[model samples]
Target chain A: MSDYKLDYLDQLESESIHIMREVAGQFERPALLFSGGKDSIVLVHLALKAFRPGKFPFPLVHIDTGHNFKEALEYRDNLAEEIGERLIVRNVEDTIKLKHLAEPKGKFASRNALQTYTLLDTIEEFKFDACIGGARRDEEKARAKERIFSVRDEFGQWNPKLQRPELWSIYNGKIDKGENVRVFPISNWTELDIWNYIKRENIKLPSIYFAHKREVIEHEGQFVAMSKFVLIEPTDKISVRKVRYRTVGDMTCTAAVESNATKIDDIINEIIATKTSERGETRIDDQVSEAAMEDRKKNGYF
Target chain B: MDILRFITAGSVDDGKSTLIGRLLYDSKSIMIDHLEAIERQTKNRDDGEIDLALLTDGLRAEREQGITIDVAYKYFSTPKRKFIIADAPGHIQYTRNMVTGASNSELIIILVDARHGVIEQTRRHSIIASLLNIPHVVVAVNKMDLVEYSEEVYNNILKDYDSLAGQLGLKNVTYIPISALNGDNIVDASQLLPWYKGDTLLNYLENVSLADDINLTNARFPVQYVIRPQTEQLHDYRGYAGKVISGIYKVGDAVTILPSGESSRISMIELGGKKVKEAFAPQSVVIHLRHDVDVSRGDVIVKDEDIPLIEQQIEVLLCWMDNKPLIAGNKYLLQINSSRVRCVVKTIDYKLNVNTLEKDLSPDKAGLNDIIRATIKTAQPIAYDSYQKLRVNGGAILIDETSNVTVGACMIQ
Candidate 1:
């Protein structure tokens, strides 16, 4: 055995597990925000380790944008069934029609921002006082300043200027009837840490994360996958390339990077040598400015 | 590798943010896009120079106001180690933010403007660092370039800081003179101050030993959950899962479960899905016992020889952090480790004046952002050591049951 201790990862894991237990003990109604991504998958596995002798006290929730990849959706349902937990899904298309969220302009116009309306509606519909997300702070600049237990106002809006002081492991999850808290157990984790952890734990992820041949078209300097939700321009020409998604999001905006990292080890080595960030490669929304994530977070987008 | 978590505290215009920016920049931990964004924003400024402080000032309000409003964390790494830097606000009103940042930090870097020497904020940060029991402290005298790199100026600041450190009972104090704006003696050694000899900031950070920071003599294990794999192959397996708070525990060691007084021997210690011969402090592992006792969450396991005191009344220094004043007779949940019990504030002994280091005995109410010495009576007996003995078990948080908000952090006397 290596005498060197993995203290950093150990500390991160302990803190996350402690937060998970606190969620179970404190909240009257709590749910995990599962998206069939690597972060959420690690969260599910941690929840299982947190309450192994008994079933999970809280259910798993997924806000479906209605433009998700088929493999990702299938993976979500299968994982929920395997873990034997209740999976609650709220569709954005229903919210667009009933809640009058926004007009479905074109096939390519993003409902990504509209999913916030659906998510807040679901939180109110289920009376969930705490919603657990898998957002890591190292992913974005705005996320770097977030508290582990981030409080939201009655409208689910985050005021960055006014936030409670979180000291030690004590989390203040206090809110009124309409107000709620967003809990991020993996807030301190980095992108590289998540990848290394997944490799170590042998956690299964969707096939889209690995390199495969797919027909894609270039839009605004990003290789957008050609899907039913994508509106291909008349002059745009599609080409086949071996690519993999650095992050999973709405098919219209999420892009893929050219790679041949088919296995987990290869992906880890690729990430170590890659120059661009994960969000830079896949998230089209962040290309506008530096504070895009902060703006979205203030408007109650997870 | 061992993790070293540290915090930076100083007054405004002390180049606190600049030092952090230089550390990140020199370590090459920042991404190209982030650097490019900072570069683009720098060009927009009238100075036409890259403002290193802009890298840490993330909020729009902070950028517009040109002041830090809250604590912002920055992560970076070198080949030798990984660091989590907590950049705390320096304003007097944000004292609570400084305390929150220094609570979990192993080291504290107090920046002092060489021209201004020792000021009120310098004393405030030094006292807070000592009060929080930070193991190491680095007093970086910044802006030496403006002072012509004078040794007399550096010595004067050192003399004033020594008096403050003496009053606060701080033993480990290291001073280094540098100009954070010009990047002198921060990441690289300075040729200007060759008369003064010491390790550079980066070198000290990489070489500072933290093995002794943890409490390895006193064993503490707070049970977080019970792990049992109810499968055919592992049908009779039962493990108590928790993070080791302090000390080292080995298989076949004699242990005592708190509140129950049940004695047993550890059967096995498993970490990261593998069995281990021994487990030490700060490691999260699942411990199996030889006997299946009635142990659940909130139970603590300790070495038999070093049993904690079981009592219903305790004295503590409480840092109140709510908008409402603390009412003496009101009951709140006092959580220590994983165990929580109803506690009533018996009396507010005194409040510490942050600047004078004196106690105000006439203050009957502990208001918001006040640090007071108080005694509390618990509904049930809790097992605990002294704050200096076991940090995990000796500290607690006061929760308002009605609001479910953590209102105060308490350290046992």
Candidate 2:
């Protein structure tokens, strides 16, 4: 309009904020699914802008896998306190203890899938009509086909066939009584865009995202950060590696890439030069099968 | 970097996915790991040669069926500009998906198979592209290698598309001849067709003149949220937050709030918390008016001299997306630019045959994927411009009252 076109980040921000407002206006009871990940961090930041001077319209819901990093949990609590918004935490451990769900055993065991049960339970418990997420299309293959207002049925199952056609900037946030919608405001953003935005905004994140000297173990050709959940075995070699996570999920399944990118700028440059896809390179949880995400999504996994 | 959004549409075998695959491949957007995965998927497939389409057939069902069912967005970048390509499905019933992709696109790439020339699907896609007000259209004559890269075959398809473009009133049309499979004339110059002189698809996409696509002459800003920083230190801060749909807004500009007829002057414009000199279309900014007008979400702020049409009834070319037939007198929640109102289908002007471009005057019903000209009466006045005049403020979507699903897409006539 003014001869100066909006840069990619600015465009992405505008679109995402517009989406956030749409969700806020359309849904009566909406909650943001915050995992304290980079994506969720951005989503929360956007909510602040979407309703600045006014508190967030909805609470921040976190489906705790009980395998999250200590730093992530700390950051999540501090952020919620600082914003003075309600943070609802539903733990997978509760479901496991109640015998409704069982934790996987043996090698490469992850609680990522179990979180879906807790998530669905939380949604029903809170009667949330819409759950906002920071999922990006560039992250996964199935995500590329997901609508911005992804609808889930009574059991929170996502049907690929029944997806409503999202046209223009108009989103249909309508849902039945038991059914809820998953709104992905950043559906069009890429990993590069996220990093650039984080750098531009100077947003603080969990320390694990940056390079640090940490005790780690090599599993399946990946340098994984050693946490309490990670069981050390004879075959697994434990050593200190200067690395940072490309994505944050369960501690057992999330892998870290070798880098010295302690600053946001270095991470941005590292992502640009990296050849592997962001989620593809890490997150062994999605490697269960070719359609792992699709299968998991059908069962209400984000 | 600026980004260009485009949609690719044609028949199933027009190699739309392969074309996208080739563009990503030649642009060095595909990584080595993804290449290895594609190679693995190619081993069991009939096409032993690395099937590029596998990369875009994202859903498992789509890959199993070997057809794209929904729009799968792909991103790639060159030195000049970043690209967001929406690979729309080609099925006749998937017209809603095609329209969804084309709604926000600045350009549409319609692949016309060289052997088949301009077919029914080409016209169908072209009509939808034009209906959605896509500014640019590129008729890519694909599969040139199948037709032996004949100049006559390419010319014939171009000639057919030119006439169709004329009939469809496609203002900006570009013709290119290439083979998405052989990577000819995609990025690098192809030596096979020396007689054809034109810029390659990648080059043209990189250098296209999109400087004037957005509407800037008309000022339209729909307030999305009201920001009142009630902090003790910065108390009494009231800002109207929204993305500028069109035109420009500067401090001290004369503006009027619609629906209330309240007038005010811009006191300040803030971008990301910092006060910016000015804001333009598509940029999200928070504005503080000099006077506290009765402004809320869905209220539009516009220049006093250039106001949009505010009326209870609007004529629109509606594209139905639901399985339920759209019947006259049925009510829906019409949402446009943050404004939502109850609306009813007053009349079905005509159920136009999208493929044949024939108007059915005796229309009885409109079902899924049906694009028809109709009149919608809203509960209150809606501020809008003709879609041809300003798409950002002129388009709307219809939601079913019970299901809460988007049932129709409307472009005001």
Q: Any residue pairs clashing in model 1, and if so which?
A: none
lDDT of 2 by residue, B174-228 (tens): 9999999999999998999898899999999998988788777798889877776
The CAPRI classification for model 1 reads as acceptable
Give the runs in model 1 whose Cα sits over 4 Å from its true position.
A1-4, A81-86, A104-108, A174-179, A235-238, A263-266, A288-290, B61-67, B227-238, B272-275, B290-292
lDDT of 1 by residue, A152-251 (tens): 8877888887777787666667677888889999987778778878887789999999999999997766788998888777988789999998888888
Question: Candidate 2's chain A scores what TM-score?
Answer: 0.97
Classified by CAPRI criteria, candidate 2 counts as medium
Winning model by lDDT = 2
Interface Cα RMSD for candidate 1? 3.0
State the DockQ of every prediction: 0.44, 0.65
Instruction: Please give, for residues B184-223, the per-residue lDDT of candidate 1 as tens digits.
Output: 8888999999988898898898889877787778898888
